[model samples]
Target: MKKYDLLIKNGVVVTTTDMYACDVAVKDGKIAAMELNMDEAEAEKVCDVNGKLVLPGALDVHTHLQMPFGGTVSADSYLSGTRAAACGGVTTIFDYPVQHAGETILGLVNSKKEILEQDACVDYAMHCCITNLNDGEILEEMEQAVAEGITSFKCFLVYKKEGMMVDDATLARLLIRAKELGAMINVHAENPDLIDLNIEKFLKEGKTSAWYHYLSRPEFVEAEADKRAVHWAKHLDAPLYIVHMADKEGLEACIEAKRQGAEVYVETCPQYLEFTCDVYKREDGRNFVCSPPIKGQESQDALWQAIKAGLIDTVATDHCPFQSYEKDWGKDDFTKIPNGCAGVENLYPYMLDAANTGKISFQRVVALCATTPAKIFGCDNKGSLVVGKDADIVIYDKDKDFTITLDSMHSDYDHTIWEGKQLHGYPVQTYLRGQLVYDNGEFVGKPGMGQYIKRSPKK
Candidate 1:
């Protein structure tokens, strides 16, 4: 009899702290052992990955799929979005459950469940957004949701006209409830009043160009709001997570809060690092516009520094993509452009390229892309190559080099913001729950294998 169900041999294994040559054994969808120089004759199925890098599957904790915004829907649905994620080496994704105005929190959850029933290509979880927050009635729903294994709740501080933004008092109440329930509060931390004030000023000045988009939501706006949210969270003794940390001031605030013993976590997206305010000014810049607009180059460099210093925790794609026809959704008006771009398919390539170029070490790369996100999101048995962890893994050829092109991508968008960019490493195969899902740019699994995972509350 074979000693293991499957064996992967002669690869450079990566974990949060170590990188070495080893063989991994998997049985019944779990990692049974990690050995060095194991004999391949003892395994039922063996893959010789002599020069590849084997790492835990990445977990993208923030993404929006089939999202409705700017009077239209984002082009990628749950099925398409997870498929893109897998092709890029991601094995699990945590997407947000959007709430429209005047809908109950439970109604939104039920609706999202129905939408996800038909197609989901990778394992998924949802962070509920608090919209239509009612007089403590919705608070009960949040409490019940905690019991149901939904660990995080997202609340926005912007979008005043859409009724999605929660005022300070309401936020305080929600935070108190979540804190009591041992759940984490995820915040969209742009200052609503500041953004609205600047929007009026810029529109009156006829500064509606794409460059003006970043100008309208200045760094001070984000910094001021993040500081406020941190203080409020501290006051309520709530664990706070700020999504998409955008500038030097925002990163500084988060770091300082952590030093002062506040439970504040941060995530940054690829657009913030790769593109900038200049992106919005290009002839095709409209296609790259996103809210909490990408900051200046100085802010971009600061974000990279923060990542290396360990202040920023995760690199997620705030992947909300609109079709090419939707580019003009904000035509003649910068504020109306749907605020997102697709990178779920491009995140791993960009990060691996960064690693190959000596921008970040291999161990740090694995930490940022996989381990930390799993820990933060309370994904049990999903982030590392330990004996008991899930068999979510990726085999990447570190020596392979390729340039990103729209023709090679699986996303539905017509163009790429990363056009002409070069990358050195990419996944040759991806596995989820011990099953091959993507191999050599081909999908080997069907929809619905990706099921809704009910995550536990934070530790």
Candidate 2:
């Protein structure tokens, strides 16, 4: 019998802090060993990844698949979403299950698990969304939720009109409760009142184009709320994770909070890092509509600087996408458009391209895309290549020339915001737990191959 299940040879292995030539061996779905020269005769199968870069699979901590929003559901289902993730070298995803009023947190989680377990193509965890306080009963369920391995919770400080926003008192209560429970609170930081006022003003003045989507929530609208959330988490001595951080002021608030030793983490998306409000000026601008709409050039620059400075914790794609027809609903009126865009299949490649072009080091790419997210969200088995860790890996062709297009994507969407964008590198193969899921531009994994990950608490 072979001593190992699989052996990968002749590649440069990269981790969060280091990169060097190494051969990786795997057995029983875990990394068995890593050494400079491993005997190929010892393995059941051998893959010689000559001239490739072997990196840990990425963990996208934010995504919305098969979710209902803006009068229609997102285009990608769990299977399609994870397939897109697999194709992009993402081995795991953290989905948000929204708890509407009159629903229990555990109930929503169980229901989502049932669906995901049947269709997911990659491992997944959930960050439960608590939209209804239920007179503190919802907050009471957090302990049970944590016990069930749903260790992180999400709260929207905006979207009050949609009934998703949690009041300041409720947020404070959640921060304190999460602190005691050793859980993390994730917030969508935007001042609802400010957004509503601007929307109303813009509509009355007939400035309701896609550009107004960016105009409605100016920098202050997001910055003020970011500052407020930081203050609450700091004072309450709790861990706070701000999602899709887009504006300069919001980033500055997080930087200051971190400087003062607050457990505040910042996450931004590829859209914010690559594009600015100018996309809103394009005729196809509707495709770029998303919450915390891509900000100005100055804000984009600030985000890149923070990433290099280590202030930004992770880069996740808030991969909630709507079809082009659904987005057209708000073409003349920004309010009616489904608010999301496709990015799961592009997240790793875009970042990898940045690294290949000397925009950032390859090691930083692994940290932002894999290691840091796994650390922050308590995905202990993932994030790095080490002995005894799950063998979720990606083989990248750093010199390959590729272009993004609708036909090249794996998600079930008719349009892509990254269409025509070129990249110097791409993931040629993806492995999940030592099993090949995607290879040579094809998804070879089946639905339900993914297992639900039970995450640990942050405390």
Clash numbers, per candidate: 0, 0
- For model 1, what is the alpha-carbon lDDT of residue 104? 67
Q: For every model shown, what is its TM-score relative to the native structure?
A: 0.97, 0.99
* Candidate 2, poorest ten consecutive residues by summed lDDT: 131-140
Residue-level lDDT of model 1, residues 1-459, one tens digit each, is 887778999888988788899999888888888989888888788888886999898888888998888888888888888888888888888888766556666677767777676777788888988876666677887878877768898989888888788888988988898888888889988888878888899999988877777887889888888898999998788999999888889888889989999989988988898877887778877888887788888899999998888888899888888887787867778887777888988887788778888998878878888898888878887878889988888999988887788887777777777778888877888888778898877777677877677777876
Off by over 4 Å in 2: none
lDDT of 1 at 424: 84
Q: Per-residue lDDT tens digits of candidate 2, residues 349-399?
A: 999999999999999999999999999988899999999999999999998
Q: Spell out the clash pairs found in candidate 1.
A: none
Candidate 2 clashing pairs? Answer: none
